[model samples]
Target: MTSAIRPPAAVLLPGTGSDEVFVRAVFGGPLAALGLPLTTPKPLPGAAVVDGFLAELDRLADQYGTLLVGGISFGAHLAAEWAVANPGRCAGLLAALPAWNGEPGPAPAALAATLTADLVAEKGVDAAIAQAEAGSPPWLAAELSRAWRGHGDGLAAGLRVAARRPAPELALLRGLDVPAGIGACTDDPIHPAAVARAWAGALPRGEYGETTLAAMGTDPESLGRATVLAYLRALTAEPVREGPLEGI
Candidate 1:
């Protein structure tokens, strides 16, 4: 994010049981405006979820050099985890709806995923999907239906694995000197706004912004803009170094 350098491409990821379509809806336009081409890699369901994402991130970073990485919820967690391990290869972050700081613990989002996984196991995907859609907002209901069905038979296992996976630790976050922009839905019980602020505070150069599930239900771009604009501010405010910012 220095004057001499910016990531050549961005790879945004989707949350558990979500898909590239949702990732595109949330981040594609904003990144396009910034002249950053976007790529959304689909998650491999079940225990392979984390490793699958890391492998694709490795491929993209190797192909494009430094990468601008970001995502929603577990997707955000995966992006941060990659940045922690590959700081030199990462240009910046645009994390939206971070569910927890480190381990899942009793985080609402994790619990929700765990319960849904159990439900799917007991009642099957179709029945679980029906129960989920009953009172959800029309937009959310539609999204849930599409994404859950899309996960197919792998849905339960994917949820279980993702629910158990830990996000990048705050100690790890402190080491990433890139522009770390964190976003949260203020009204989302699953992803707390405070957790987003904590992530922002943990990084050396970080910014935080707020959107809402209501806004997300209507326009996914509202979530994108909230996160990306914060990233822009962090980028602008970051001090340019005498040497390439590529090396940590």
Candidate 2:
């Protein structure tokens, strides 16, 4: 009997200081339901650590013959960077809550990583959660607090790495012909709508949408599934003549 044909593989990169568990709960669950060949979500190795995360991606590309790259926040930024570097082998890019596409400032992830780690170390998870919840939607604060507790050390390390992460240059993403789907939020302080607009203005194929941490946690599976569907469709489909990033 012939084996069943699998769908193309997707590489998921989590936000800074995040691990597979949180990413899976928030992003992977939905993408997996689509029946795509999904690889395990992985953290991008820090420069200091020098783990061969990029090399693994290269291997996956060779083994699968094609790949779709998707990420959240810092993950999204990295995905864009990788897509720019490897346009031919990449199937597409799914960038969620992309931060600082071309802005000149510290990368949000670096700031978040350091601050989150500091909060965790000083106030403990419960206190940190409470503090964050003071301003953030309850659901997001809760989910992230849980993540903070579970991944404090890694978060600290990632913060250190992020603090040094340079702002992503436009040249890295400009003129790339590959299709891309970008998800943004209306209320996220870190993920400004203007940033999304800028990204839409630059990529060859870019679609913009909205999401929130509270909404995401309320129905992570549904949110992730919808996002993956949108991303996959964008990946296989042709670019729309007037997408968000058309003029750029």
Candidate 3:
């Protein structure tokens, strides 16, 4: 009996305005358990430069050979897009808290636009961080504040890039045959459970799991560990065989 080969690496992508540190914490250890390399490039460019994100995935597919791509929010949508186009090379996709089909609502965009304008003004990036973090959950606020401390003024420009990026289209997601896992949460107002169900339905065979950032972020390690284990289990499960069988 021939044994199936496991994916050689897992490329993790972060959500909007988030850095590699956050993505790593979400998938690093589970990857370690599977003896797989984890790759997370820098935050993707703005809507005008979205190809940078695609290019990184393309490069990883070329280098890794049967790669499993995963992401959160916008990153998840992008991962799904790449998996669809390069199904032969992709092992599966793991997406967490995906957003609307394409483009965020006006509320998030307005916040991002405000931060961009504030950074350009005299008060500097510190003022913008303080303003934005004020309304966020305590753990998230702390993480964003830390990023600001490290990157200073540059973080403001990154936020604009994040806010303006578009989501993947439904046509892009409907025909994929690879295994997929949709990680969702109940408390997240932006990521509706209905969307998760829709995405799951599109795949030939996909798994759905639930989680919350409020709990996950509080202890970042737990989220990464849980996500990776869930993903590995799904990927190793049997694929949905198509075109009639001997038994049928």
> Estimated TM-score per prediction?
0.92, 0.77, 0.77
* Candidate 2: segments with Cα more than 4 A from true spot: 1-6, 44-52, 102-110, 120-130, 133-135, 222-226, 229-233, 236-248
Off by over 4 Å in 3: 1-6, 44-49, 103-123, 148-157, 225-248
Clashes of 2: 3
**lDDT for each residue of candidate 3 in 91-122, tens digit (9 for 90 to 100):** 87777766656555564433555455456455
Model 3 — TM-score against the truth? 0.77
Q: Summarize candidate 1's per-residue lDDT along 1-248 as a digit string, tens digits.
A: 65866546889899988888898988888788777889999888776878899999999999988899999999999999999999999999999999998889999999999999999999899998898889688888888899998888899999988999899899999999999779989999888999999999999989997889999888888888778878877888954331442121
Question: Compared to the true structure, candidate 1 yields what TM-score?
Answer: 0.92
Candidate number that wins on TM-score, 1 or 3: 1
lDDT of 2 by residue, 11-112 (tens): 867666555565566565556555565665555434332134456667888888778877777677766776777888788777776778555366554566
Q: How accurate is candidate 3 locally (lDDT)?
A: 0.66
TM-score for candidate 2, please give it.
Answer: 0.77
lDDT winner, 1 or 3: 1
